[model samples]
Target: MHALFKHLRQVRDGGQRREYSRYLAQRMGPMIHALMLVGALAYLVAVIAGTLVRHSPLPLWLRLAPLPLLLLIAASTRRVRQPGLLSTLTLLCVALLEIGINLNGADDLHRQSVVLPGLLLPVASSVIWLGRWDFIAAMLLCALGPLPMLLSGNIDSALVFQYLVYMAIAIVLSTVLRAFMARTLFEQFRLERQLREQANTDGLTGLLVRNRFLELARSALAELHRQRQPACMLFVDADRFKQLNDQYGHAAGDAALVALAATLRRQTRAGDLIGRIGGEEFAMLLPGNSLEQGCRRAEQLRLSMHEIRRPDGPLTTSIGVACSQRCRDDIQTLLARADQAMRQAKNTGRDRVVCSPDDC
Candidate 1:
């Protein structure tokens, strides 16, 4: 029961986890449609068989009662966007079919065998494509499908006991199978996420890698353009970084880089993008900031870097500030200008902020 509730919570929480929800919906939609179509065809064949070979005790209309529901389910599966909704509807359709068959075939012993096997279909479907609440709904409906027959005294006591035992076994098996599949799917999603992070992020600083940072900067620039807002880019290079590396070991250099990354993360807004674009250089994209605002921010960052203490001495950074309002340039061109400004700061002094010449 605890496991069942845990699975239910996972399904309920899936809306917050968009990637997993989308993947589940895409996979389950086709499975539901295919299963409904096959079920409809099999029912059609069964009706023909009953009419030609052995006269069914139930009326033809009674046996065909679930056909329209099956078709409706198939159509709905294609249109429904949420996986939880689709699974619920599919389980309901299966349950309705089970009830209809049991009620229609209550008088015949041979018909009971055929009708009872239909109960397994919902259990199997729920195991393969649904969560705990869905599975429970399917189990309840399928298990109680023969209840009307039992109440009416149509089925013998021995047959009733046997059917109940079969249902118990089916439920247990379905539960186990659902657990295994859910765990495997979760592990696969976790691994894929880790791989994506490794590809996009720097291993040392945990900032965006050079190429990924450029891609994101381009996206941010496009967004700012659409909003008719100004955006700023800051190109930051560590001052006298080679001297620090020469005096200390490479490990000290790595630690300084990591510390710089942490400082940048702390000083920037949540929406800002920070990246390690080179060995001793980093970049930041600040959306909605004009040239004047960008220069102020760059100066603040420069001061913060100077305050960062290292084993050898205090660290300092040279920052170049560029803004979208300064000129009609693409992201790459703006970044190039910012890099040139940073070089100017480097040439004049070791630690300072410089705006683009035109903007200055």
Candidate 2:
């Protein structure tokens, strides 16, 4: 059906609709956790089989059964949740569960209490997921899960005491390590976000740079295509910029350019893309705009630039407007049309707006 295909398209692109990916990642963690439990069962069976068969070493196939599951879990964890936290907790739980059953199967002299150390790991994880105060409460429950076995005389008295000491040490160590790791992850994520924002934005005017402009334009075009809507591109060039730079000095020229860039930002909508493409040349991409609307917007920008004449010398700007057509799928074509129109505006006279050939 059309609806089914649309849903598939949304998932396949993995853009804008990222909740599905997040959900998939979250679910995969539990699935891998289930796989770990299966691995524990398989490992138990292999140990029992080897004991009964009186084999010095378990068969390679039996030993290999859990290896694949471990690798799968390790690989899958990175794609789902925070690897530092979720994977560590999963590994700790699996280790505890494995040690618990192994201890249960050991001979009287070799038996040791491992359940306490193992159970405390999930408590640490719960603490990480919740908070430190909540974890303290959760740790009590964790201690209780292993206490029944230790108090029932199934485990040796010395082993129980040793486990209690070891559990205490593990609780302190794991909590400290996990807390440090959690802070490190949070710091890294915050730094990454800041860097991404810096990269997308211009240093001087706080507008988007040319590189980011192209990215946003492409993304907008994709959305426009989906909605069957038209968009427009406007290219603006400061008239007699070279003359102004020569007469008033480059610093004054720079100030004028920055002022113009600020004007563009103020004039455009939240959805519009405004970028300084080159020295004294800027571009704007407006979605859901027709050729006439594009012309009016370009005229408005031109008038705003004319009104804000620099103190050293009056400044003027020329604008070229191009609207997307039935055959126009690429940004370059729209830009070329706008560029041609801008050149035409420059040729005719300064401080005027020019319409694209498509508009004419």
Candidate 3:
């Protein structure tokens, strides 16, 4: 039940829906092209067969007139980049094909013998559509496409009723096929997104993992450099993480870590980047912060300590601030400097903030 609700939420979320649509279109693009090509060729064959076999009273030019337009729509589908647009274009091609059929059988004399071709399009379209709008539109055209030919020709009323029954069955078949395919694609989309999220984030802290953090930090640093901005990196270490585990059990240590992470999230600006670098270690990148500002922020964090609770009543962190004046340095440089200062803070006495190279 929870999974079903999650799927529904994904379906209703505008951003998620857009993502799913793009994926669906990309995965099915080649198939859509192949099927459209085949539909065009099959349509051409049916038109020619109708003209030759029934000795259609309609001129050959008139019977074949819509063929070029039908192929044009089919060709246009190759360049269709949007999700719903392809469905519309493909349906237009189906419409044109139906037009050609009606033109060939307009003469009452030929309707009886030419009826089968019109019936085929309705059933064969089970896989061609991408959504409800296109499916409904295509089904309408395919279902009634043979009507004029049957009514105008010498066919009896009972045969006409049977043709309608055939179209009903085609509608059911197309609906079931489209629904099954759509559900499968949506489930695949949901599963892939879940895997991506799990891979990119730390399981316990809900923070970006090391490699993902580095990738985003690099991109952000490049942007800041382009704009001639300053940034700071803060390397935070739990001062007695191992001792906490030894004295109070791993559960207390894990609880303290979770609280520490929550504090970092609450204290940072929206633009700042935070990551769990590894066990008992975390890093933060603050865009547009100067050396003094970074040091001030680190001091505030040391004093408050995210309210981490332990058997000894509280826990503390050692923070190192590394700053760039003009955002000229890479993430690696800032990280190295910050790590050095954090080690200094740990050596000189824990629960304090230190700036690299005695700059501040």
For each candidate in turn, the TM-score is: 0.79, 0.61, 0.75
**Residue 2 C-alpha lDDT in model 1:** 56
**Lowest-sum lDDT 10-residue window in model 1:** 4-13
Q: Which is superior by lDDT, 1 or 3?
A: 3
RMSD of each: 4.2, 10.4, 4.6
Q: What local lDDT score does residue 342 receive in model 3, on the 0 to 100 scale?
A: 97
Which of the predicted structures, 2 or 3, would earn the higher TM-score when compared with the native? 3
Off by over 4 Å in 2: 1-112, 119-172, 182-203, 306-309, 357-360
Candidates arranged by TM-score, highest first: 1, 3, 2
Candidate 3, position 113, lDDT: 46
Predict model 1's lDDT versus the native.
0.77
**Largest lDDT belongs to which candidate?**
3
lDDT of 1 by residue, 130-180 (tens): 455666777787777766666464446776777778778877777777777
Q: By TM-score, how accurate is candidate 3?
A: 0.75
**Winner of 1 and 2 under lDDT:** 1
lDDT of 2 by residue, 1-360 (tens): 233223334334444234433333354456555555555555556456545654333344544444555555545554557434554555444545444433443332333424433444553454233233445544554554465555554647776777677767766665665466445434444466579779998877777888888888988977886887888899999988888889889888888888898889789886898887888888899999988899999998888886567755567888998988555467777877888899999999878999885642
Q: Given candidate 3, what's the lDDT at residue 292?
A: 86
Model 3 spans with C-alpha error above 4 angstroms: 1-10, 56-81, 108-123, 128-164, 223-234, 264-273, 285-305, 321-328, 337-360
